[model samples]
Target: MIPKLAILRRSGLLTLALGVFFLYQSLKLELGSWNEPGPGLWPLLLSLLVLTASFVLLIGNSEGGAGSEKKPFAALLRDSRLPLAAIASLVLFIVLSRYAGLTLAGGIMLLAWLRLLGKEKWTTSIVVAAGLTALCHVLFAVALQVPLPEDWLLALWSAGR
Candidate 1:
């Protein structure tokens, strides 16, 4: 059986791979000039952040949550439904974002993560999700002048105007 620590390490490795992929994709886009930033700037920065975090996770000290008990990896995989679901939710968020703006997708994703994964109260989850979504819009769309994907609802509204 694989030790819990090993599983954690493996997860870190997986994260690292994902981070690398993001970085690579970001590199393909134009990393615009400052003041008149290009679309790629945000993605590039975000991907680098992911890379850094994943690297830290990979090398970080062993934590208490992952038990020291030696168990088969299969068992670990079988017992990781929540983690798996979280991952799936992330994929959903991405797909949703492609059609719906980040505000909507991010709100839904944040709400799910907070309420389901964090097991927070629904009111708390809703409040946080709304606040965070607004904050994200202000940061990315307003402050940074980054264009986010147009959600169907927003697109429809604009078309009607």
Candidate 2:
């Protein structure tokens, strides 16, 4: 294994360790039978999946590659737009949802993420945003019958209705 690729193995080992730690932590939560999954089930499964992937990444080929040095954390973050956009989206989503209601806030946030941050085509962004909004509606409003916030828009909507 090239020395550079060894970084990947070490990094993967760290991630695998963290995944294992989370998996262990998740075990403390209730793990219901397969027929009735408890809170721990999803986290445990996800952690196990992460553990598997990290292990694979750690051991995978180093033959065809230049074992490049890892970028500095600051440099990595400076080069990436997604993290900042995601954080902004969260803050904007919360504030927008407070006034606009879930549907509008969610739609706008998804649009911003897809179009601006993700650099998706307009048609694709719009479709994805609409689909996700509809999916959220179905999940929370229709299927689960969960009561959403009576934000300004929702209040006005109910008042008019």
Candidate 3:
């Protein structure tokens, strides 16, 4: 129980520290009006909420029982593979998007990630990847009229049309 409380304390402290850091960054940005919230507003509020939650956890742990058993930190770290994989996939998507354009890159990234990291079925991965690509195309290219990257492969396809 003591070990558990200690772990909780450490995690809470880390969260609180991150919250403070974000709060400081947010303070540097202009917080817009209530109706027209600026980019910093959401981050500021979220950091505050995180800080408050951390504080609550820290305080609660101080008087805790039956949570003293310490779990191995190595085990905790090892169990974080899925999150790390997801982050890696996002990084890969960003890098690939520059060369392959949004739709093709996104589709390939989603399919590979879902199939490999998520261990999803091939059919499911294909369907999901295709759906996500189409949805993103509609949202960014059609609806928002945002200009995504134009790869030579897609250009050739367009030229043939």
lDDT of 3 by residue, 1-161 (tens): 44554666676677688779979999888889799999889879977987896676566556535756434432433232454465567678879878777777789889988898778999999999999988887898789998777865557767999
Error of 1 at 142 (Å): 9.4
TM-score winner: 1
Using all chains and alpha carbons, the TM-scores for the candidates as numbered come to 0.64, 0.52, 0.52
Worst lDDT 10-window in candidate 2 = 72-81
* lDDT tens digits, residue span 1-161, model 1: 97656766776677678778988988888887888788788888877877786666555624545555433443434333455567789899989888776778899999999998888999999999999988887888789998766667556756999
Judged by lDDT relative to the true structure, which candidate is superior, 2 or 3?
2
* Total backbone clashes of candidate 1, pairs 3 or more residues apart or in separate chains: 2
Model 3 lDDT, full chain set: 0.74
Stretches of candidate 3 exceeding 4 Å from the true structure: 1-79
lDDT of each: 0.75, 0.74, 0.74
